[model samples]
Target: MPQISAFDVVGPIMVGPSSSHTAGAVRLGLAARRILGEPVTHADIGLHGSFAATHWGHRTDVAILAGLLGMSMDDSRIPQAKELADAAGLQYAFQTVDLGDVHPNSVRMRVLGKENSIEVVGASVGGGRICIYEIDRFEVEIDGSYTVLLARYKDQPGVVADITRILASYGINIAFMKVSRKTRGSDALLVAETDDPIVDDVLELVRQLQGGIVARRLPRF
Candidate 1:
């Protein structure tokens, strides 16, 4: 038998009606926002499966917009997400899409900022829990259960070792680590989940690594 946690029993505290449709959608959006690491100027969101079939009635669209706008799931302003977005100068659109072989309640977001852009694909599994599967076309598995460190850099030998070494120097225990690259000796992405929060100083050290790496921290939800 699967062990049930408190979240499983009580579900998430949220504004929308359904956990899977509303809370999950909000989390998915938040994950994308964190990965982008900037204010969202424009967003092109694609809904799949159940999300595409009945998003309007469940307020999934509004929930997603609310998340992108940096609102929490329980925020009172979720129902007014569109209006809030307009006030914040955010432009967005949603469309149904075929995201092959993914969870039913999934979304793909292409978000643009003033100086950067990111493409994130993820799903809200249940109880407001989400799994971020892809970022910038790199396959990954991030569940937002721990503080996450994301680094993008030119593929090179010893890069992973150096990163782990930095974490070790700070006594930060790594809960999980995943590395993916487009091709040998090309661009790569590192996803490291830690048991403790990574302070800005540590993140800055990661940014100073060789190969012009760009590093960002995503706090646990």
Candidate 2:
């Protein structure tokens, strides 16, 4: 059994009039930025249900975009986020998407950068808690705690082993993993949540594999 603390019941520390709509949204954005594999160039953001309709009122739009640009909550630029993105040389857009059967406080983002593009979905789960539902096509649920490794590679044998070996070489342990593919022998992203921060050399090893893998590391703070 787990001990329930007063703080856990009272909730998380955050800047907010609304934790689920604001703070959690920011965390979600940062998480997405991490797995995108490179600095963001173009961004197309979509909000669903209640998020689509009322996000602006809650400043969810600002929070979400700020996350992708790697801006902390205290960053002054959050008030004029679109301008900030442009001034900082980041491309960004915001629109609404109907998210069915999922949480209402949700945002999905498509971010483009120098060498890669990615789509990430996350929901603010009240009290500043957020959950990452997917990245591109991989299905996952992230609690915003651990560093993540996102890799795309040819769907063949030994891929998982190769990744595990490389992580083992560096003493990195995978706490969880999710693999996805649209079809057999097609490409896939190996989404891994690790026990500790990831170093760049591990990514280099993954890129060296014959099947070809685009790798990235995301740290959750």
Tell me, by lDDT, which candidate is best: 1
List per-prediction Cα lDDT, in the order shown: 0.91, 0.80
| Tens digit of per-residue lDDT, candidate 2, span 142-220 | 7768888888888988898899899999999899998888788997778889997788899898989877688888887
Candidate 1 stretches with Cα past 4 Å from truth are: none
Specify the poorest-scoring 10-residue window by lDDT in model 1: 7-16
Model 2 is weakest, by summed lDDT over 10 consecutive residues, at 71-80
The lDDT of model 2 is 0.80
TM-score of 2: 0.90
- TM-scores of the candidates in the order shown: 0.96, 0.90
